[model samples]
Target: MTKAANFIWYELMTSDPAGAAAFYGAVVGWTIAGGADPQAGGVDYRMIGRRDGGNAGGVLALNADMLAGGARPCWMGYLHVADVDAAIAAIEADGGVVHMPATDLSVGRIAMLSDPQGATFYIMDPIPPAGAEDMESDVFSVTEAQHVRWNELATSDPDAAIAFYRRHFGWGQDGAMEMGELGSYRFVQRGDVMLGAVMPLMPGMPAPAWSYYIGVDDIDRAAAAVTANGGTITNEPMEIPGGEFAMNAVDPQGAAVGFVGPRGG
Candidate 1:
């Protein structure tokens, strides 16, 4: 990971990779290309808005024949770390488990981990794309990491979650916000910018699931695009209490994602 501690790849493991890529393209106006574009590669691995030959992300084909090891369809976030092995060691030492040991990729090494609370994510140490400069970025690029604004972990215990992150990454909690119905929402900041949240899961929800939010230019248009693209619209377009208009949607692969307009400061 030659870049800062920022998110790199935003992968979606789904039943049909091709269809998923098409769905995202229609909904987000992104030109799904690279291996994700079946015309470009034979494999099901596909990408959206591919340019500069960076390893941003793609939808992995998980059809019945392809699906194995009981991996459910979900949106996964991959952060660029300095060292894959070191990150694995830190994750396990912080009460996490190595869900997937370090695996070698053409670009770099990757490994998946789940915190003690069962929230799963991955870390990657990219090889800088051979002759390329770097794949990571300093500021969060909304267009690059599509459907990924912040990486939030809904832990069973917020206190323990904060402690674990602090011990592992030196990040601290930025305090909390109380939604009318969502109740208290704790904000976590890597340093100054609010990276994401650590909220309690809803009733009967899975324990400690990690989800990423995609920032959009217009919430209404984004939600409309979801339906137009053959994707399922989970939440109708609506304005939150603070004038934040958003809509929830799931790609063709059944990975839930949300699109929000400009967020008020």
Candidate 2:
């Protein structure tokens, strides 16, 4: 199968790795393990493992150097591309900015980037694991709890954002929803699979950003767990299409996140 240009990994950079691990484990039901190990360059990096199997993402210790450099507690998505250098050039040509140029890592080459609207993410050309035929799928199905279920983008210029991605990543318009005064909610897809949507940033929203939604078994229960664990529920569970519910929230370390699942409250 041809590798699609998609989000291949997700990560959270936070000031309190232990606090974040405890909070998200309770809220998302992920098994957080390993910390301050010599294996991770001795930087206190930890893995966010899903209950079902495989790693869901990672949590990196936010150090003083990063904090001095204006880095805050935030969630970042790593996009998979065939060529990192080529993707960087395309991004620059499209009015996007490159925060970090392509650099080699143990896993692959990565470049930190932001859209024309200033929504930051990573673009990477990953090295396949030993004995694996190909890189595992990064985005997960909606039916599975404890995995990424949706990818959403809120940009100042939705039309321009959509065009930029389509031009660079080969994404297509699957469908759209009219949002009255808020403009159109456009669904973006690769081939027949709908990955996510782009919409105009609502008033009071920080910067143009991508919010990933993780699947949960019970929306109400998860929302409660979020609050109980020191995370804030920014948006309560609300019904969406297909009888599932969705919500917006902030993790304990302050990374914005989303959740989707069956409604109970």
Best by TM-score: 2
Q: What value does the lDDT take at residue 67 in candidate 2?
A: 90
Query: lDDT of all the models against the reference?
Result: 0.69, 0.85
Candidate 2 structure quality by residue, lDDT tens digits, 82-168: 899988987898799999899987778999999999989999888888888565665466567888888899999998898888887
Which ten contiguous residues of candidate 1 have the minimum total lDDT? 137-146
lDDT tens readout by residue for model 1, 1-265: 1223566678778886667767766655555553545442455676655334443466677756646678878888877777889888878876899988999876678998987888888888877756667544432453433445666777788788777776666676877878667566888776676677788877766678887766665666677678877788866877754576667777766787776665331
RMSD of each: 4.0, 2.0
TM-score, candidate number 1 = 0.82
Clashing pairs in model 1, backbone N/Cα/C closer than 3 A: 1-125, 36-46, 149-213
**Candidate 2, poorest ten consecutive residues by summed lDDT:** 133-142
